[model samples]
Target: MAPATQPLLRAALLLLLLLLATSHQATGAVVATELRCQCLKTVSRIDFQDIQSLKVTPPGPHCTKTEVIATLKNGQEVCLDPEAPLVRRIIQKILNNAKSS
Candidate 1:
């Protein structure tokens, strides 16, 4: 190994390490944000006939509010307000059906 080139080689290695660390932190921040929430807005009501399916996600460490996502027959999804009276009644009905089964 030539002494004259040793410093340049060390500098290149340090730069590479710094780049890697910065990218790792950026990627981690993206992943953390992705896990935080899935719904930003909620509607108080939806046409019952248009709904094809429903997904209910209870509050957890990632979010503090209960999320109700409905997939319409036309393939569009919307978030329903869990606190709405109609939504609450529907949820209770579904739970009762599940329990009876």
Candidate 2:
């Protein structure tokens, strides 16, 4: 190994270790409930006891603008801010989506 590149190699290795350490905190394993997006939907039968806050619209057989704050299956409370369209869209899409089991 060239002595001139030793420092660069050490820095690269350190960066890799740092990334791995932080990623290790959150296991890649996703709970089955988490996979089921319907849990976020108001019409879904899935339980929402874990949700901290919710603002659901009147049930009329269709989804409404009023958002609902709920905890994900992973025991994470997700706040669906009305102002953030990105957040609202992503959550709604996921909650209403179905994946082959």
Candidate 3:
């Protein structure tokens, strides 16, 4: 490639990346609070011990049972049971929260 062409190529790549990011930012539809989910149910069934490893991502490690569990305003205990789908849902919740903020 010629020397002049190199800068043009770099500039084009950067512009493409910027456009892709802008498009993505515009694509997520705003969802109502009622339509959003906060609790996830267990699928495979897990005991108390498995709850310890739940922390895996940033802002710190995964949430322990004590940390993740919250008492709702209505006095209901919201907790995660480590079954099959439960782990996936918990991870997704964390990721979703990260994206929204």
**In candidate 3, where is summed lDDT lowest over 10 consecutive residues?**
24-33
Top lDDT model:
1
TM-score of 1: 0.59
1 against 3, candidate with superior TM-score: 1
lDDT of prediction 1: 0.69
CA lDDT, every prediction? Answer: 0.69, 0.44, 0.41
Worst lDDT run of 10 residues, candidate 2, spans: 24-33
lDDT of 2 by residue, 1-101 (tens): 99999999999999897555433111231112222221242222233444444433332334344444455556544434444555565556555753422
Cα lDDT tens digits, model 1, 8-82, are 999999989755543312112211124555565677776677778788988999888788877778766677788
What is the RMSD of candidate 3? 16.4
Model 1's C-alpha root-mean-square deviation from the true structure amounts to: 11.0
| lDDT of each residue in 1-101, candidate 3, tens digit only | 89999999999999897555433110121111222232233223333333423433222233222223322244333344334476557667757878999
In model 2, which regions exceed 4 Å deviation? 24-101
RMSD of each: 11.0, 14.2, 16.4
**Candidate 1 off by > 4 Å:** 1-33, 99-101
Order of the predicted models by TM-score, top scorer first? 1, 2, 3
Comparing candidate 1 with candidate 2, which one achieves the higher TM-score?
1
